[model samples]
Target: MRECLELAPDAIEVDQASVVQRLGSSRTNCENGLFQESFTAAQGFLAATARPRCVVQTVDLATFAGLYDGEGSNDRDTPLEVILERSEALALFVLTLGQTITDTIRRLFSEHDYLVAALLDGMASLVAESLVESLETRFGRHIAECDGKSTTPAVLAYSPGYCGWHVSGQRALFSVLKPNEIGVSLGAGCMMRPLKSVSGVLVAGEPEIHDFDPGYSCCSGCDTLECRARIARVTGPVCAKREVAWICSDG
Candidate 1:
């Protein structure tokens, strides 16, 4: 069954430090007057505008493998495929910060309020990520519950348009996940409509499954290489294994 999540704005937790970092400026060096004003305005706008929503549907490994390969153009040998093949469970999900935020961003840009617009744009990206992080944690707990075990599986999300998963792969994914039910639509080039939204599959398995060398052919063109930091969070010595719980609500 597909699960729906309606998250409160405060639950998204967009901290100023993270916003500053997302904006390409560190708090320590961010003393510019305009930057400060924009940052403050972005925070306020996000607080008033963010409407975090998510939909997730879990599928057996075989089903996901078909979806992953259905596109026919994806490089099956990529690190993302390797990690997912090792997963004990998988779920497809779409998360959006709602249309109002994107509309406001367009308005800001039209009015030449570039500074605040950029800051809000970056902050919205962070909030979308934060929503994914929360889902991963909750889904990890749900896995433990379903197995009737005390395991703390590491659940991480991987999307198309990166790591050799062709952007067109979204077609196969959207066919099954049907994000349009929650107002997220795939447009030309497979970009989600809200612009601040994210869609992907969450893989649950031992933390070690996520570890991969960054020397893969796909990694050559990638600039972010964000998987390293995410893997480190799960595999690090201080990584905590919390109990799993169901991610969807009856309400």
Candidate 2:
């Protein structure tokens, strides 16, 4: 893992729509009132404050098993196990906007500016997601360069605590990759220290899996109200209107 590794990405473009979605607003709703003010402020805060960083380690799937299984499993089937079944190699990464972002959030909360805090939170998440997307882009190009195939490679990224994988298993990720190098640490609760950080594995060349979009903004599989907004935008039917009614009714 140490012999062949890529340092965390430096910086990435912030996706405003995704940030607004994370703030619980749709593309249309993001255009007005507090949502617009918060969105603009969030963009400014990100422009001045966000410090995007990421680290990627390329290893054989077998090495991944040795690291993950050796640490421990959550009783539920580990996603690494599934990836190992199909792939010979995988990319593991830990990414975070520096601690300053979290510090800003704490200060915002102390100042009772909850709206801005929430907006900053969304901005941080979007930056992390963008980092992951950057990794996918680079990995696909790397694979294509090595294989020289006309078709682009397919890669899947999965994180802990989602898709039935237990959050406790995140310890194994920290074990193999030195999150400390990128200014991240693991808490006792299996959470990343910077709070806005994300860690996950990227699996490539698995024939069993069909979809290979390495990023997600909104979907039914997600629990965010933005999923309903996405559905309504595309299909003209509001499947989860009640789910997001509170946002409209909020004081």
- The Cα local distance difference test for each model comes to 0.83, 0.62
Give one digit per residue, the lDDT tens place, for model 2 in 6-67: 32223345667777666777688667788678767766776677666667778776666665
RMSD of each: 2.5, 10.4
Top TM-score prediction, candidate number: 1
Clashes of 1: 3
Clashing pairs in 1: 141-244, 141-245, 142-245
